[model samples]
Target: MKLIGSTSSPYVRKVRIVMAEKKLDYRFEAEDVWSEQTQIASSNPLGKVPCLIMEGSEAMFDSRVIVEYLDTLSPVGKLIPQGGRDRAAVKTWEALADGLLDASILARLEATWPSRQANERSQAWIDRQMEKIDLALVAMDKGLGDKPFCSGIHFSLSDIAVGCALGYLDFRFPALDWRARHPALEKLATKLALRQSFTDTLPS
Candidate 1:
């Protein structure tokens, strides 16, 4: 198996953490999605990072899909639940965390464009994304009140996704001061950071 992505991508980090937690070994092929030489389009029509190529070159796009498939490969960590409402609940948390990252990445990229930097419309769009991120942090904190992990006591996919999302914010928006606003999340991030998986996959 091979994992294709950039270190800076939060989505990629999610998949990498899943792989590490599962104790699965795979070749890591880092690529710059923004580079014209990138082959992401061949494996993924959307030309996205975090594309996984299995032994036979079966390409898996989308971090959610790849991570879920990887979870089934080994019983080591079992990030997602097997069945029942528990599975849905964990997936819901993953969706929320992924959505938060999606918005943050969009806003960060939009801010880099010189034209968008001066355009009120673009700024408004970025503001909306930031608002969504803010609300998501509050909701996550509330949902995580007095819990050791996001979905339950055990560290699961929800924790991995949330950790990656928060790490992305720390890497890109240091000025946001999210730790002060959401202490619960800060605690979660701090604990997860001690894990080898998180440390190994930290974005450069």
Candidate 2:
């Protein structure tokens, strides 16, 4: 198995965290997906990070799919729930987190472009996305109240997905004041993020 992505990508970091939590072994191919036409784009056709090429000629794209597949590699620790409403909730959390990343990345690219090409008109679009982020945080806090992790009772894939989301915000949009606003999430992330899986995979 081989994973191809850049070190600074949150999606890639999520896969790395899953691999560590599941204790799966694989070769890593670090490439900037946005750099140029490369093997990652050819293999996955999405031109995205965290594309996993399996040994049996299977190419898995998207962090969610890649992480889920990697979780099946080990028996001791399962990152994603097997089935039920719990699994649906985990998938929902992942969707929200990944959506937030997409929105953030768009805003970042819009900001980084040449001033003439910059889309200042899209600030409202980004603001709407931020509102979704806030709503998702509130939902997570309510669902996670007084619990050790999300999805109730176990540290499932939901936790890792949300953790990566929060870490990405910390890395890119520190002005959002996430920790100050959500102390519960702050403590939760602080407690669980100490593991090497979280610490080492932080966005650079």
Measured by lDDT, the strongest candidate is 1
The digit string of per-residue lDDT tens for model 1 on 112-161 reads 85554355447788999999999999999999988999998999999999
lDDT of each: 0.93, 0.81
Query: Could you tell me every candidate's TM-score relative to the true structure?
Result: 0.96, 0.91
Worst 10 residues of 1 by lDDT: 113-122
Residue runs of model 2 more than 4 Å from their true location after superposition: 115-121
Candidate 1 Cα errors over 4 Å, as ranges: 114-117
Q: After superposition, how far is residue 127 of candidate 1 from its true place, in Å?
A: 0.6
Worst 10 residues of 2 by lDDT: 112-121
Candidate 1 — what's its lDDT?
Answer: 0.93
Best by TM-score: 1
What is the lDDT for 131 in model 2? Answer: 80
